[model samples]
Target: MDRSFEIQCPPFDLELSRWDTVFPHWGRSFPPSHARRIHCFSLGRNADKESLVGHLHVAFHHTVQRVPFLAGSIVPSLEGGNHQRKVVPQGVARLDIRDLSHKLSFDRLAEEGFSQHLLAEVLCSTEDNTPHVCLFEANFIDRGLLLVVSISHIVADGRGVTEMIKIFAQNLCKAQAGLIGYPLETTQEVYRSDRRRIVTGNGVPGPVEAHPALTSAAAGTHSRLADVGTCCRTYRIGADALVALKKAASSAANNSWISTNDAISAFIWRSIMVARHRAGFLDAGNEVHVAQPVDCRALLGLEEPYFGNAIYMTQGSLPFADLAGAATGLSAAARIIRAQIRTATAERFRDVVGCSERAEQEPHTRMKIADDVLAGGIILTSHFKFGLHQVDFGPAFEGRHVKALRFPVRGTMVGAVIVLPRLPDGSCEFMITEQGRTVECLVDDVFCRFTAETKTAKSVLPPSPTSPSRNGQAEFVFPESTSVKESTALNMTTLQAPHTGTIKIIEMNRPKAKNAISLQMLRQLHDEVERIHGENTTGGTRVLILASALDDVFCAGADLKQRSVMSDAQVEEFLALLRETTCKLAQLPIPTIAAVAGAALGGGLELALCCHLRVFSSTAVVGLPETKLGIIPGAGGTYRLPRIVGISHARDVILTGRRVEAQEAFAMGLCNRLVSHDSSGTERGRALQAAIELATDICGGAPLAVRAATGALSLASPAGEEAAYASLLHTTDRLEGLSSFGEKRAAVFVGE
Candidate 1:
């Protein structure tokens, strides 16, 4: 009853253009998370099978000639260097044909639609690891033919696929018209790899180093990995309803225009919230977060037809209670979503791209959201602007155009909504994936009425005023505690041994240049840690917290301005000393934490990486940007970062010098915790307080046990767990822990 056959054509070679290399980084960082989009087109009444097959073969050959990359295979860079791997278009593109004419009528195929299992089999039939395009056709007896094209995400994004399909359709039309020669003007010009288009300044410093495969966290986060019990339903929203929703949102806010996407996103978000509340899945106090991916080709000044992964995923958060109440809730939610969309300016897009580039350089850094945010978040992707309706196959075809395009459900998350292009009747289709109860509640009369009805009120609210500034320039305000005082006890560095020396706080004191580490400062830090280790022989100091006294900067890395005066030999000596000091800090018997408030770059980040854990303020950014200066991260960064995050992520960070913000750092496991700044206090103050509290909590644990655990976990990289287990077995703290557990009280033990 099940029938499908794949024909692998002869292989062809294609030399990659400059643009091909630019895409390898995207493929390396983000593997295919979503299944290949299968668009079903009705080919009217079927003609003779032999004639149809012959026509299709000639059209496909012409398509390959016009778009050579479709038959190419993605080749990754093998040697470690700055040059990205090339896409060698030297492979066969498979054509799959499935005949359901005997088992089912054409009407039946149209009525029942393609099952998930059948579509998945056709798209995922390829067993190779490389990326190549494929085409599938399902034939029915009475109605027509169903055509499905599968494109790898690694090769192209949605926009790219759309363009390729358009070209193929055009080629088919030309052949059907009996034209001997197709116009060259109809062919698309392949763009070159122009770093100037994506990034500013000197562009990519050198050839890109090949990164490893993506980690599960980074690659699987955006995928549709939902449960088996889940169902996919398509809801139609008429143009009139969309207009009414937008009008309601616009009227609710003073002179604020709401886009159609914003209005629909808000409506869907509110519906989900209501459904969750009705099903007892809503948390009253927590905020509901929505993430949307925005294509940034226009923002980056690239042409609309540019082919690549040029999208940034951004998020917005709103109070759950706000979206669960009256009709006004929908309007308010729309405003919030609109504001989030508006914030994605050119500068923000550049920042995200820069971060991606840096992440690509590091062999181990992964880009992910915080655990709390990912659990209940809603991800909405709108493809209405893709112009899917305009894809014309040929005059011989039945419908001659795509009726609808559907994306497969690949995630097990709670909310995922995809908005397709408008139908011929001006009705938009929304493919929603959620729990059965949530879907049932969303389709009920109550929520449906809210979306269908229009608000009659014309009352316009007043626009919020902007912050006042003198002469169109904002005034600078300094933190209350900007004054720096000296401590003579530790002359080399500023050491605060509060809580009877149980928690040692070492603050980098250079404020003039944002705490840049000079050679003398490095030496002083080394000696100070050595002294602290020697003094804590009796387990008096259980935790060490590294911080910066400056209000905005934790540490800016090596003192480049100072290093300009130093001889070449002095620079080498300083680097050696910096490496040794960081190693000593990492090997410390007690637990260590880095409390970062602002920028931590190069050696600054290297020092933080040496610590057992890191706590970052909302404003903190960490990266190893030595590659920008035509150098590599020499001080243990190349080695330690991979062990921390993973080799793939490490390559992204190291090679591209991407700056990692606090939230992303926490998600990637680069920072153990993230601390948001308080409105009433400076960021540095909040971060320091958090660090002190964390150190205090660590101090409460049995000091000997903490030391033993730290030593064992540190041995995981070099000697593996055997050394760690041997070390743990020799420690008497294990017996103490067991005895305390039996005694049903906190463990209090001596160094013995």
Candidate 2:
């Protein structure tokens, strides 16, 4: 029942078009060694194993019969014209089943993570000496079955493989329903493998312009594995970070509006530039290129389920200063990428096709690529919405549920970045193969800010020795302040202002109770809000930051000990005051940011939610755990939670009363940014510093305009909004903005 052997494919010869022949070896040895595209499915235990394997076998047989080209080997074209290769009927595939139920389990494998050796066992290598175009390995283990399908890039692209799987799963579904040899003609979607549709471009009238994508030194060839000292590392970007990145990038691009892919690509490109600079792999004046593969199926009007490589390359470049500069660099990089993608029109693709045709005819006429690409620049491939994550196996084992899906890239060239499919939480995982030293340099705080999985990065460390403990008796460590800063202390809170800026900080310091919201703390917080409001009328404050003095705790929600001693009447009064305080906090005339370093539960989370922006440390955990206490969030949590992370997520968090990790919190839009801990500061201090940096960025804008925008965002009435806008029209700052734009310089604005 469990043995490894070849399953011979039926006989058939198929003709290939110019598109197929244009590729090296007709795409048979696409990447030389690692050409197989594999998808692993985890089928849980309790399914009928024999029935599942039998159904798959029958389904695959019918699949190969329908898509006969997949079951044929690429051979020299018998016509012997310009065509280089044709698919010949041969032993083109193998199917193997192995049972390791006693030796392994799905849970254990997951616990250890997927290693190369483990993946090899689950999905056998397609590098066998035999010229099989496809390979299937079914590994039976405890708690599930590991079904792996490896298809050669020779016959199909990633999309084509998905289509083939769709057909195969349909066949399996039919077999599962007790129907044998169901009519293939009944299939709703037909398979189309004619590469000629995309190769319609005859030849350019004159010499084709060299594309930036193919201007490298190697020119149409990938960097040799032996030439670059490359290493692979995987990183995950949370959804919140993605949102923030897209927003910032769009703002810097003057609101041109870029997609998440563009934003992340820009970020990755800039991060690489920084890493390369640190590793001494880049020069100050060097121009770095980013090559992206654009799928041409939709561009060329191809039908659904079309097979073959319908992808063309588009690339962009920027000087090191513009690409990796401290200010607006990511936005600049994103704009360049967006411009390049816009240029990849149908006409441009036809030109590329024409050039490819000529290259196929004349070996010396092949396109060349920029030397910077292979010499440490990035080649990012996005599989964001490829449908690879949702591959279904159809009713054989009840339903197809994939616990995890990984596309391993082995032996790829340096600066190779593959954006994998999104996880269930909407976070993205990227597999980057880059120079060893450059990869090492990527683990810094500057890069880790946008990444969720930074454990491998040295910048994300544990709490420093100076951080506060759970007992709350340790000395509080606040972020560094200038000597000219002024401080005002209330009972349980402190208000501080830097020497220059009008940005103010309200630090909660009830260290004995982990900065929990007590009656006195609430009263003091209300008094500070009133004080800040009066000062703001005279243009004294531009931004306000909410933070806790304690490092290990932002706030532990309500003080349980105090609440336990309170009567129902006292609790209701406390809730009323808490609600009023939060309302005032949210209605602040200036931007407010909460710097949360540790736990923010129930009322604590609700308090942070009142801010315009929330900055969380890597060690932070947040939740609305009132449901666990047989109560619902009372202090604006019910209303604001839904508005922030959506009703579904709000319900899941508040109703279930489960704590969310920092990454998950960010992914749910509970936090604006997640800062990592560095060796120079404590975790809480780092979060506070990040918040201050954000405040400083906001402070650079005209004060009145910033306040107006903040008011509009906080749900100002339409009339109020109009009045606010009209009030700013005659201000000196408005005149300065216009003059600066006309003069091509940054506007300098005073409070006016």
Candidate 3:
């Protein structure tokens, strides 16, 4: 039983160092921690664990056309000789981690592999362990998906190196029994038992006598991905600098019990409160959350080493109005944070999470998190003591390589408060983002009050004290970085399908007559029909999609009320164009599809019959309803209606002039597909996207094959009347279709 024989591939076992040798730039972009974990995985494709590490270079597909700051996905590593590493539409690499973690629900893992997008993002942010790591969010959209990777490099290097990531996935998958994994990096029993760590003022000592395993890095380097920024200025007060700064921070908060974190959170909160007040959102609720990281390592006991980070957050939420009151200062805000910390026990965390399942008949009022929920908020987090600064990369430089990597990530609407600790002094550093100047003033007040005596406080955005600033200015405007490049990728789409050159969309813009066509409308449509017939690359025209604006209703059907205003010659001209347009559309070289989103009655229903297939939405109402005005359908309706929905049903509806709903129209064969429309234009846009995607698939085939299929679908009445079709039988479209279809699957059409 040679287990080595079970190795997936030669590339799968390339070992971490092999990547540094094979791909020249692998070592440059990624830190050793990241490179070591993924280098063993397959690089060219998803062969094994090695590729998972190597796959970090794959870029993301972004549907958000507006964001200029972020790359949609991945920090690509491939350069130089590897042409295959270029961005191409293909399959993705997979991961073996979380092979059924109860927390991450990825049962769909068998269907698609662990998204290369997800694992690589975790790797990128896990690089450093000092900076605080923000939460990552992923959004799924109609076009594609948007993934956000936010983390503080203070936790780990830009590359998060974990034993779970470094080992080959296939090797672990084959290891089987728990005996082989005796020293599991994380265990459920240990995590469950240590869920409640103490909140002592002083940090506890390492696990020595009580337990061995718990003390061995239960908390490892911080591992999260975010683009981080820091704003810090050091201040000195004579010799005892540390003691004095702590005194000012605590004194501003006016609480002997409050730690430096509470004071910082309070300061950041007050700044935001003033900013919100000036932004004209004075009446709206402006609640901000200040989140502090909580480590449960000591609870796991002295035996644990800081192996992999296991933590949660303590959040304090305060309203902006509370800070805006003239008497309320940093001390008042700090008191609130102190109260929140007092209430924030492990039991409270469990209770809040448990409340949902244990509610007493409360109505579930949660919006869908996918498209709507989790959209807007203000969140603050700190990773001050995550020990990420200790990351050593075997002397790459005279100093450390990675630093904090985090940025204020925007949601539908979200602001941020970020904090990091300066070394030696241990005082906190902060970065804040909000919308207004009132908040900026409060932030200035907090800073001036804390470091007032002798510390030099500078700002990337300095307040204009000497300059004549606006008196009690209500708004604070941050300069926006404007650099938007329009994408030319859209124009590259070529429209060359069998039905492309044939389909013409006609919009009647007459507002007065409820958009009903009079003599002029008939003439315009008639001329366009002729142009379509002349230019159609197919031997004849195929489809015509007609629409109108009642400029409110689709059409009121006919202008019969104004018929007496016209002479007989004028009447003849109008009837001729209507008949010509209808006949031309029906005699198209292939099948046509009519889409009705509103009313289709009388002349409208008569015109609709020109198409071979009709699709109507639930909003559409269809009928002949013309004879009520004591006249029959004028356009080729009398004959074409019978040819379409059958003579029996046609006579019943046309004679009685009864209107039918969209679903009824489908049942009677007057409509082919039934679609529902939302106010969002989602259903309609999806149809267009589907159409274009289908067109893209068809365009991949030879253009001639589609043209010949158009020939076969033509509505020639009899065998003797197929002379034009006979000539096309000898064309290149026929030869390509015969050759391609004979090979099975699809016929590659080449329009010759």
Candidate 4:
């Protein structure tokens, strides 16, 4: 009955396994203590609370007798110092029950998308006054019951916990069957708790190769890992999608055999990498490493029921381009993952154990490992094989009424992807934890595809300005419009002229902020640009005129107030997004015109540089003033400005951080047109009118011809020129043009 016991030596002290020793040294990286695994089980409408709690306690007591370490506390051994720790057996682990039938319900949680706040209310408290006690807390709600278990990772891996749960459930079932105190028979001979057997190697260590987890921290791959504000999102992949993915992967691998794990893991990895690239967290030139925790019980000759941390980190690497590529990326990534898995043999695990033990002895190397393991490129942990779905409490209640399981995490490392247990139908749930913005971007990336299938899933995406079509493969669809002021959406508005086929105008609004580019504004702009890029193949738009609604200023550049509050990671992400948006704008298939009526400084000037033509009013001033703020123009200004004007002019504009007047800018070939305030309209109005006129003129030309001409110029090669000419040879527009010339009449040509 005594729950508290004095710490003793000898029999009470259990030696720590090598796997446990390498798990971040209890309380450094793992808050409060070494890694804690939290699992929640939703028992639907099971109202036998009194009986269940009694049974759970009885079952836990009996299970603890078999696995005594479950009720123990891990501490540094008195003789071995902190480097060699051991678990001291305490007493019984407690089970607490709470009735919250009045405040919460399963339906309410589902309605609220199972938010973290609500989850925290149900899950066992992260704060444990008795840190030594690994306990279970059951929260009872209306029409449901929630059971949460928290266990230290040092004492057990997922399989170990699963085994414990299995025994506990089996005993509960036995109690329900009138065998109240009878302990379920376990394979005691096969069960081994000795840490030495986990790593069968000589004490003498060999040379350790640099691990990705250790090296990535020093290389600064995830420098912002700690600074980033993190959040978790859940998604479920249906059985059909898994089947399709496996088939597609196999075909892509030239009919080579592939496993379901490889296919799904590869698919998720590729999707995330692509999302990261689109979110500006990574670039195509960078290479990303994925570390998967492989269960080493089988490889190390340990039985399935063996307790302790018998896990090893297996790593696979891929270039961003390969993972994010449109073709064969999924299969390539899958092959890489499979290769890594195949290489995780017994010999390799022994080598890893040797390397790990040797590295941990060195303070510098140990710290590096602890820091980098969480901050590395990615860590994929799959719990599908843990038999979570097979957990049965008893036949007395709805034994199969396990609705959902949640891990109420207080914190997360960078790029952590946890594959949760599979549903009865083979569908798998995923928990992705990352920076707030990265999660937002990931939501957009994943939801933008197969949205129809995930209609029941919670959506964390902000309301899109334009609804993308979910027919088959999802695509952004821009609604056709006539000449009218487009309704204000997120940041900007779109307007299309009646006479100019598809010549659209993007008006930057936010007069109060002086059209400053905030993160939201940048995301919206990027989304619009991407939509236009997709529309290009269908000849949806002919010309794009970038203008501002504010009369006195085109844009004041990045919102300094917003930037001041942003973290370094956020700033970097924003800058990357701005840079990518500008690059996309510059590479538009159609002609692009920027109407700068007033001050266009720093990123504002960079935005103008992306346009093919810059039309500035006489009252306008342009310059890259980023140098004044102790920063360079990050949004392609430093590179594009020199490409636009000569290097001398670009240097004069950038180095001094001095604004150039419209006349000076035009003289230096910075602006294509400098319009004076004529009788037409005000300074800003006149600038927009001039840009519109230019766009109208461009729209008059054959769309195909103009597109071909721009493509040829962009390519700037003999092959490009020939291809451009050949592309027009068979077009209906060419025939129309010839007929118009011969007949001396204007040709009414379609885009084709």
Q: Which lDDT values do the candidates have, in the order given?
A: 0.61, 0.67, 0.39, 0.67
What is candidate 3's CA lDDT for residue 591? Answer: 46
Q: Which of the predicted structures, 1 or 3, would earn the higher TM-score when compared with the native? A: 1
lDDT of 1 by residue, 1-752 (tens): 23343333333433332233433344332334223566655555646554555555556666665655566666666633353454554565655555655554434434444443334443444332435555545443444555566665545566777777787778777777776232322234452344335443223322222111112244554344422246556555555556555665564446778888787788777766766554445666777777676776677687656555655556777777676555466678788788777766666655544434444454433323222223355767788777778778776666777655666554324466777776665556666766654554454313443332111102211111122346663222211121111121112223333323367788887654567886556765888788777875454667888988877788889888768756687688888888889989988978999989899999889989999989899999999999999889877999999989999889989899999888888888898878865697888888888888887777665565567668877775656555655665655566777888999987765554
- Candidate 4 lDDT, 1-752, residue by residue in tens: 11222211112345666656664342144322433444334454645666666666567666665666666766665653355656776454556667777878766775565555576765546564355536666667776666666667667766677788778778778777768653433223322356766565445545444333333123332444566666666766666656666665664436667788887788777766665655566656777677777788787787667767766666788776676555567678888888778777777667656665655455344323233333226677788777677788676456443556666667556567777778777777777776655554444343334322122423432222223244543222212220011122232434453323577788776655687887756877888889889884444777888888888888889989768868898788888888889999999988899999988988888889999899999999888888889988888888889988989998898899998999999999999988976676789888988998998778777888888998898888999999999999999889999999999998777777
Sorted by lDDT (best first), the order is 2, 4, 1, 3
**Model 1 segments beyond 4 Å from truth?**
1-35, 79-86, 103-106, 109-130, 133-142, 180-229, 360-375, 409-414, 448-752
State the TM-score for model 1: 0.50
Candidate 4 at 13: error in angstroms?
A: 6.6
**Candidate 3 lDDT, tens digit per residue, 618-678?**
6778788768877788887788888778999889988989888877877888776677656
TM-score for all models, in order of appearance:
0.50, 0.57, 0.31, 0.63
| Winner of 3 and 4 under lDDT | 4
